[model samples]
Target: MTDFTEYAKALRARIDIALNQVIPETPNSQLAEAMRYSLASGGKRIRPLLLFAGYRATAGQQEHPALEIAACALEAIHAYSLIHDDLPAMDDDALRRGRPTCHLAFDEALAILAGDALQTLAFELLADTPGLTDSTRVQLIRSLSRAAGMRGMVVGQAIDLAAVDTELNITRLEHMHRCKTGALIDASVTMGALIGGASDQQLNILARYSRSLGLAFQVHDDILDVTADTATLGKQQGADLARNKPTYVSLLGLSSAQARAYELYQEALTALAELDGDTELLQRIAHYVIERRH
Candidate 1:
């Protein structure tokens, strides 16, 4: 049997090493300590794996120096988002990845600074990472900035903050999630494709595939929030419900949310069908996204 878990584990090991290289552990700087705390706090490393999968699928298994840096940048941004999201002003999450959140472990001010530093560091890595043409670097920077900035995650967060206790239709909820979660997910794939020198046609196809996959990822998260335990989830289960956030399971019910996830998984697969490359890893990743327990 093909063990994607083994592949994922090896890849995550490599990713962690590269990430450590990007931000060395500093005993002198408390801010750096806080930053390292969350960055090293293990999660699934899903975005970096997706980025690598997109690159390998499009550009074969050839190595690129910038690929590692890009992966680190994406993970850094993800880590930063989590730090901010756990702040008292945001989701107020006290636990993450089975450890106290940044704010709880460190002072809120330090946590805020750590998130800011990570966010800027992500752009710095993109802007300066070697092995890519200036044009390619600019493209990567633009793609990441848009996905992480107001046009993407920030706006989605704003919408989410305003949406507490309010009812939303399926379309609105999907849009919110697309911006909040899907944009960066799509960027992970698109940026990898760009690094792999994907053609316009390939880019478009992958965009379609990523869009569906991103939504499926979020839908599954909603389902997990309702059904999973805090210990299993590495965070407070039902946090969304406690905050009165409208999730897929809240609006569509548990069974319907599960069905929606399956539907999006199929859509992601269908989009991948048009791509010509070694997409077996990508296909497996799409399946894993919806099927992961945490």
Candidate 2:
């Protein structure tokens, strides 16, 4: 039983500093403020944490500059996704991380622009990452772009939007989530492994671990929608149900959804066990993903 709480806290602090350095205050105060507002709004920072864990799992020694940039870039992408996801055209969320949503805190147009800026900034960070070989940088950029672009998160969002009020089977729902949330997560692990110079076999094993963990992450989220309160969840409780969204809980019932989360948790751990290096952190993250309240 590794204490992942302390590991997460330490890595999160490092990631926070990196993010602040990468997204410094600029001349354009409003856009900067909106960008900082959403980026700084505290969430789990799970993606970056997973990235670091992947690095560790590959026997990465020091905190490479490229690894830091990759972690920050992933967080930037995730923050941008949240900004757009909360827009009026999307989930129309009024709350995020226990505070007003970006669109409500700032204006809608600004929020949209802020998301756009963050998305571009993410790429810029990847492109300008220092000390990495050009090939490594290209691989990181390509993986991240695919994860964030039409083939990944965007298509997932499109599927989710279209599936609203429409019946979706468990397989279709899983596929949607794999594209939507899982792609980015898989990229995080892959990017970290690439930075650490993981072998192809190690990368494949990590991919399996990340994929299972990603779905478990979403499954737990669905469970929390029905189980946790607004303040506890840092957003509206039952918002998914209110929107008639197809969640694991909605499709499989709460008990079944919980069971499925545990199943995925085991699957992730199993994959991680196949990898060489200190994988305790990744294993603990799998546990955290399934057991998290929000």
Candidate 3:
């Protein structure tokens, strides 16, 4: 197997640099600091990495100015979601990425404002993406908006909140996760493919890949919550169980969850095999998703 560690690191460095450039520094503004804090707090940067991989697979370019903005915008949406998800009204977690969550580090109100600012900034970045046509920009904006809004992540969160302490069948659980976690992931790859000028057929294949991989991502997360510790996870361990949220592990047991993740991994690889161009990076990512420890 190819070691994608260095490849992932290089793409992550580019994404971090682009993120810093997109969000200006303002010491006087607490909101800016909060926004920057959450963005800078380290995670895997999986969504942006997927975007870069999709771009590389289709465009055959290692880097592009337009791809940078698109990746950063998607990450901003992700960062904003995390910020809100950790609020007192939401997950109410005290830690994230091994540091205090935005609400705890700053204040609740400021954290909320920071999330709001980042969300709008995401759209703004897409609206003014340099080198893309107006139609392309609009498409990107629309794609991200739907992924981040009611039709996607928002509704998913609503389902999660409602499902607390309630039983969810496998189909309902998958649907909930597809909306919450899978939608933006789907958007990430498709948006990258769009920018890279992928044909409709290629886009359809990628959708299949992303859909399966997205659910697998959440399944592995649920496994980690049970098997990993607080320091290792960078967040409260068992937070999902504490919230009484349904998970693959909760509903299907640990062994079955692992089985499900591997099944999805195979599906993702199957979809990737049907696509053209250098899909080595995307293939490696699918492997990483299923086998990741944290």
Best by TM-score: 1
Q: Rate the local accuracy (lDDT) of all candidates.
A: 0.92, 0.90, 0.90
TM-score, structure 3 vs. true: 0.97
Which of 1 and 2 is the better model by TM-score?
1
Q: Lowest-scoring 10 consecutive residues by lDDT in candidate 1? A: 19-28
TM-score of each: 0.97, 0.97, 0.97
Q: What is the lDDT of residue 49 in candidate 1?
A: 83
The list of candidate 2 runs beyond 4 A from truth reads none
Best by lDDT: 1
Better of 1 and 3 by lDDT: 1
Error of 2 at 267 (Å): 0.8
How would you encode candidate 3's per-residue C-alpha lDDT over 45-85 as one tens digit per residue?
89988987888788896566788889889999999999998
Extract clashing residue pairs from model 2. Answer: none
Q: How many clashes does each candidate structure show, in the order listed?
A: 0, 0, 0
lDDT of 2 by residue, 1-294 (tens): 346798788778888877777776678899998998888777898999888888889965567767778888999999999999999999999999999999999899999999999999999998998988899899999999999999899999999999989999999999999999999999999998898889999999999999998899889998999999999999999998999999998899999999999999999988987887888878888888887878
